[model samples]
Target chain A: MPTVYITAPRDVAPEIARTLVEERLAACVNRLACDSVYRWDGEVLTDEEAVLLAKTTDERYAALRDRVVDLHPSEVPCIERFDESDILDAFGNWRAESVGEG
Target chain B: MPTVYITAPRDVAPEIARTLVEERLAACVNRLACDSVYRWDGEVLTDEEAVLLAKTTDERYAALRDRVVDLHPSEVPCIERFDESDILDAFGNWRAESVGEG
Candidate 1:
């Protein structure tokens, strides 16, 4: 299975999380509130935001990104996806079960 | 080679990140300002915090944790580590090179 962790402005996490799950693009979404400091344009500023770690199949990644962007509050939300191997069997099974064998 | 990632509160990220890299416990650190929403104490409250993703070797994980706690601002900073496999050869080599072999 592949894991995609998206970092977005805090307020929009719940909306994005609910949408991904309801749409079956992800099996589960773990949301966390945190701060982010980075260089945007020229200046470095710190702000509070929400983090969403979403578990999904590699096949569904593209669709998930499109959906997330549509629902995200920021213009360029951080959407990073990476390949994960040897995932816990129980977690992988749960993810498959959540999305009905997807 | 084994790879590990740590996520910490936003503000404490820089302190922890700098400490880990300087001490040769980590190869590289990615800092993001994000929001984390979770059950703390008895209620779910929202807060602004820095997010840190530190890349380190498996051997150094224990010491890294101890050092991060010593400098972290929060009483209980979130410290979670898991095995990461199929890492890019370049990245793994960079990590090893950073800490000078293991």
Candidate 2:
């Protein structure tokens, strides 16, 4: 299974999160308010942001990524996938069911 | 590098997050408020929770996990690690420095 981490501007996170869940691309989306610090265009900057941890399986990752990119506000959004091997069985089953695999 | 996901009640998240950073077990921690649903004791339960995404290197994961478990309120807290191979170099360097690896 893969948990996709997506960073979005605070204002737009809810919409993006809703779309991913509604489209069945993700089983669940955990939205967190955060401060992102990074170097962009030769300058280091920090901004208030929201991160969405989207739970989905390998089979659905590509679609979820595409949908996130399409709905995101940034030209090059930070969409990273972390493959997990130790997921709890019950949570995994729930995720599978949510994405129509179960 | 690994990002450790830890779930705790909202009230305790800040203290746990602060300890992880202060001890240099994690470079940074992103705290997010969310709902967690799962089966416990043969009953499905839902609760408000805060998740901490703690960024650390492989070398520090064990210590971080131990510290988190000690500081956490739950007996068996959710402490999961996701290793990353596609991390941005700049961010990785920053993480390394923050954890005194640089």
Candidate 3:
């Protein structure tokens, strides 16, 4: 299983996160408010954003990613994958069950 | 190189992030406000927290982890390691140099 890390516009992230959970692509989504600093057009810019950590199984990752691209307003969305190196067994079970996995 | 994922009290997160950056334990720390839901002592609880994503190198991770543990007030702090699966070359270079890895 992997947790997908994604950054999206602050105004748009909540709905997208809810959609993923409602559609069963993720067991749950953790949304966080952030200020993302990056270099764009040769200038450093800081923009308000949200980071979504979606707990999902590997089987659903591709679909989750595609849906994010479909919903995200950014032209080049920031999506990163992280393997769960360590996790509490009970929480893992809960997450797996929530996602309709074993 | 890896990004350390840690959770802290919302009020304490900012200072911890700043200290890590100032002490060179991390090149930068991304802070985000979140509400974490988990089962504690047979009760499900949701607590407002801050997520600290600390960018550091392999050689520096142990030190970073120790520093985070020291600063975190939680009896058992949440600190997870994530290897960079893929990153933009220029960004990677900057991150590496920022942490004194390059």
Provide the RMSD of all predictions against the true structure, rounded to 1 decimal.
8.1, 6.7, 6.5
For residues B21-96, write the lDDT of model 3, one tens digit per residue.
7666776677788889998899999999988888777878999999899998988999998896644344456555
Share of reference contacts kept by candidate 2: 0.14
Better of 1 and 3 by TM-score: 3
Highest-lDDT candidate? 2
Candidate 2 residue A92 C-alpha distance from true site, Å: 18
- Candidate closer to the true structure by TM-score (higher is better), 1 or 2: 2
lDDT of 1 by residue, B1-102 (tens): 433445566656677776666667766555666677878889998877665665667777787778878887778777777555334344456556665332
lDDT string, candidate 2, A1-102, tens digits: 888888889999999999899989999999888755443443434567899989998788888888887898776676667788698999999998898433
Tell me what TM-score chain B of candidate 3 gets against the true chain B: 0.90
lDDT of the candidates, in the order given: 0.67, 0.80, 0.78
User: Interface RMSD for every prediction, one decimal?
Assistant: 7.3, 5.1, 4.6
Colliding residue pairs in candidate 3: none
The model with the greater DockQ, 1 or 3, is: 3
Per-residue lDDT over A2-79 for candidate 3, one digit per residue giving the tens place of the 0 to 100 score = 888887889999999999999888999998888554433433345778889999987788888888888988666766
Model 2 stretches astray by more than 4 angstroms: A1-32, A35-48, A52-102
Who is ahead in lDDT, 2 or 3? 2
Predicted complex 1: DockQ: 0.09
lDDT (tens digit, per residue) of candidate 2 on B52-73: 8888888999999999989987
CAPRI category for model 3 = incorrect
